[model samples]
Target chain A: MVTVTKPLSSTDSPYQSRGLLSTLRRSPLTLLTHLSVIVIVVMWTLPTAGLLISSLRDKEQLAVSGWWTSLSPSTQRLMVRSVPPDAQLEEGGRYVLRGKVSDDQALQVLAFGWSSREPAAYAVGDVAQMRKGQTLSISSNGEYELSSPEPFSGARGKRLFYTAKIPPRFGLDNYREVLTTGGIGQSFINSLTVTIPATVIPILIAAFAAYALSWMAMPGRGLLIALIVGLLVVPLQMSLIPLLRMYNQIGSTFGVDAKSYLGIWLAHTGFGLPLAIYLLRNYIANLPKEIIESARVDGANDFEIFTRIILPLSFPALASFAIFQFLWVWNDLLVATVFLGTGEQQMVLTARLREMLGSYGGNWEVLTASAFVSMAVPLLVFFSLQRYLVRGLLSGSVK
Target chain B: MTHLLSSLVIMLLGVAACGFYFVFSNWLLLRIFPVRRVSLQQQAVNIQRAALIRPWLFLAPALGFLGLYLVYPVVESVRLSLFDRGGDAFVGVANYRWLFASEEFQESLLNNLLWLLVVPACSTFLGLVIAAMTDKVRWGNIAKSLVFMPMAISFIGASIIWKFIYEYRGEGSEQIGLLNAVVEYLGGTAQPWITLHFWNNLFLMVILVWIQTGFAMVILSAALRGIPEETVEAAVLDGANGVQIFFKIMIPQIWSTIAVVWTTITITVLKVFDIVLAMTNGQWKTQVLANMMYDWMFRGGGDFGRGAAIAVIIMVAVIPVMIWNIRQANAQMEGR
Candidate 1:
């Protein structure tokens, strides 16, 4: 095997053909490997890219053509009717019918046909002869007039088939509609109400707990740590029914609504505690022991030491957990749906998005824009503070 | 806008209250036990008392929340599973029996099994491959970042993204969904992928795999980088090829990390409710445990016993991971 690999030495390798004089020596396998990685990246990003592009495309065009063809003008075959029989008036010794063939939107008429079988048979502005003694005329701008020697008498308008070249239009109308009219705007505020406190409240509580777990000597610290770690993997589904019941009972006793912003904040705080404490404790414990020692020597109590020393020192960990909690609470649907009010005043963004999914499942424009709106914050957090996010992931998993 | 202002004010007040509690409580503790003013013996006693009391004070809020949110609910759920739908009468094992007998529950269990088997395996495998390949090329960080971008997306948002890709148009129309478009381009009839029987589950799993592979990649990529380079050099000296070195050298070193990523994704798969709830609403054989639990919770005036029982089932499914996590934490603590 070693002798057989002698000719494949790195210096003589065919893949390193980028320099010169090795045109025939280039390895297709290496090229293929690089191409495959590119393929994977494209595959991963294509779906979101589709959503973004489709969201921006004109809703009319979005319905028919794929987003891949979003840049090109879309061609649509439409059937519109001329003026009804009653609208027909005698003009120039012929009974005439007239109306605009297209809707209010500016559309360039590419072709027109009197028959459905050949929808685009006649070029724009070409008037076709009808089998009946009538002449048809259509303009590229979608205006049409039909004249017949015989007086037209029908209750329904005459059907005219045409192909229109709709320019590729893009706008934020979808987002505007969803935000202004879809109640997502209200839900955005509600999401903030849920996320801000839910993110901040836990850090304080967990910081205190983490300090105790990390430094303060207590009985059963190991068991407590173990328990919390085990709780880390306890599925959140386990807590829902009981917590809902508890909230309902408490709300009844207090004569208040159970699904309030405060309720979700507390619920989030509770559910987020285990991971927060676990991560923060891990970091706080790893702090150089000498700092806490020095503070102790200076007559600082545990509280002072924790606040003055450990809290500031654990900024990275705090930021890490804060982002984690923020994203978790922001992206949470099940918890928000269960604990928060579903009314227009209290529905969070995720719940709002899910509602949109049910009500407007077929409307891609609405779904994509609303989904993107909900995703915007987390994506911003992910991109802006990716260092801390990645660091948290590394510490959480690889530790 | 008024809502925004009020929420902001409430947030500030809440934060202020938390700060005040910590400061005032710590101040109270110090006042109650003045270590400096006492005699040496009394000071030591004060210090000990303060030390003992301080930890509890520090741990109180977190423990309270954890107890209320996690521990209490867990106990309450167990109690609830024994009670009737109204949670009034004791009904032992009836919910479990119903769960076992219901074809919907059985289908959900099978689907959960399929999700468990496929999502973690596919995500980890693809993650490993991408992590390894991306490490070799320039612009790898950007590629990794783009791939990891999905990690930040909500599962609901991700379902919408994938939903657009799975959008179906009738035959002879221009196929808009990417999957169907590609299928049509490749000379195959477009399939409404998410609605297909027995395979729609896999189609949904693809979205999760797409989302989670980045997670696995990031963790595994870090683990791969942590592997000492000397080992790979030695493997090369031993005549190991690229594939052999990867399988024999690098993977063995990061095997535990792989397990961590796998189990992490597994836990996520077990609790994945949003994707299914949004995608198909547990229809067409796509119901998983968590969504089914949610359905039972509020389907018709709510069925507490059945809901809690379903939760218990999910909890039971997660027990192995919980045990492993505890063992791992204990081991880490011991090592420290």
Candidate 2:
């Protein structure tokens, strides 16, 4: 029995390794998991990828061809007029009309035909026979020579149809156009204007509030905390009408524009406060109480202890909230549309994108480029400081 | 350029103003209290007074902003909902009555409910699946980051991305929109996706779900990682397979986090406006509450009463979740 067991164990070792290899190869669940993840990742990624790719594509190509086809030279059918009859001159023995079908120099003529029915019937560099003993030769360079036994006589030159292989052209022309002409350049500035003060002021106000709510022995502190929590989900729609009226009243009282940058900044600061205070307070409250207590016992005032210690210790929380407010205020469309004027001077990036959606809906080149310009800063902020963002989310939501 | 510079200056001024308030108020409190060289009894009184005054001082700016912004708006929105379009006359529930009677409001309500039902559930479910699957993989962080990347995109930007995906040309034209291109490639005729009535709402909701799935995944992934290894070991010892461990042990442990994710996404869906505004603009029967409120706010010189009423409806829908959130916070505070 001992001998049999020893042999069995020895045999099982080799079989076990082979079995593990086979299982790894044959695991349908693992394969399915990987495939599904790939599919999801692709689905999640393709939209933005399309946007980026489409933004760089030539405007004409973007209109006609799918962005997927932007890399390959797109085949297009075209009709070009030969040199007018007056330009035809006797060359050697036959009357010849010589000119380039396309003068742009970007299009490479692939084929040519005299009739519209079969525009690409004759390959480029081939002489095609015409009705009246005429011969038309077109080259890959788009130069064409039309010769006829009889002198070419007409008010207009012969209509030549050819297929051209237009090269794939990609550039920053779309961005240049959108920025200089599409009004996004101005909106980009407006977005920053709204975002900067909106982001900074809220942190200052909320940090103090958070410090007070968390560490101070204030009466009604519990009530304020609960109030902030409740206000966390208050839809911004609830505030627009009232705030608009208030701003209008103040503007009329002072004879200033109702939707100035200051009003919108205050509006954003107001809208962003509850979450700011809540997230910061939660983080500030969780600080090791011994530090504050020891500082207090050392005769440091609450103000001194907060400024000298708690503020510095709460850097991560502060950074996280800053990223949050920056993204929130930057991406905000509803608040901007309502509080900021829709005029060119005050429109923010999101608002500009929305307006462009209506006016430039069909122009994907403009739309994609403009959208990316607006999204660039946030995406930069997101990728660079995503850790803080995730940290903010984790602390702000679950706790 | 001048606009940009002025805004920077304003931002610095705002910061300086806040700093001045905090520093000056604290200085005044300290000077009045004089904790450094006072009688012991006087020091005690001074410290008490400063303690009482300092919290309010620290709290004053935030409270002032919150009061003027959130609390005041909520109260004033309720009042405005009862006023006329001009906001001068008392209408007294006339707007609410009109809202109940209007076909557009009903459509918006139904669509909002549809969005609330689908967006959060879909986003949370997708987020859960991704979080669960991405775990124990080498490239999980990269995959998770790609998924979460959409959360950084503005809704308007997302709408343009999706609008291009849904773009349609006439029959036989090469389908440029990705959806239509796929359909054509699969031997199906291209259909204008966002113009279809019932499905358009789903199309719009997909944008939200796409943006929100990453958020859900990150939060849920963190929660999933937090599951104790011993629980899985205990289950494995009981002869439970991977699926059983996942279903019974893992999901149950992270249930609260899932709830947190679901509720958060639900709140975002309630504010669904930009996508609808940009996509179909309430056309094709795709109006939601937020967009409808925005429309009424400005349609034909504006209807503040009806708009505020819609805003109030949105606020009312959020009240339950708000209560649940506060209760959750209170419970956690108790644990602390």
Give model 2 RMSD, 1 decimal.
6.8
Tens digits of per-residue lDDT for model 2 on A1-399? 001001101222212344444644777776666677878899999999999999999998898879998889998788888889899899778899999877667889888899999888999878999998999999998899999988888799899999899999899999999999999999998899889889988998999899999888878988888889999999999999999889889999999999899888898898889989988887888888888899989988887888899888888888988999999889999988888899888899999999889988799999999999999999999999988888888888945
TM-score for candidate 2: 0.94
In candidate 2, position B233 carries an lDDT of 86
lDDT of 1 by residue, A129-150 (tens): 9878888888988899999999
Error of 2 at B167 (Å): 1.1
DockQ scores of the candidates: 0.56, 0.56
Model 2 alpha-carbon drift over 4 Å, by segment = A1-28, A92-95, A103-106, A114-118, A125-135, A147-158
The candidate maximizing lDDT is 2
- State which docking tier applies to candidate 2: medium
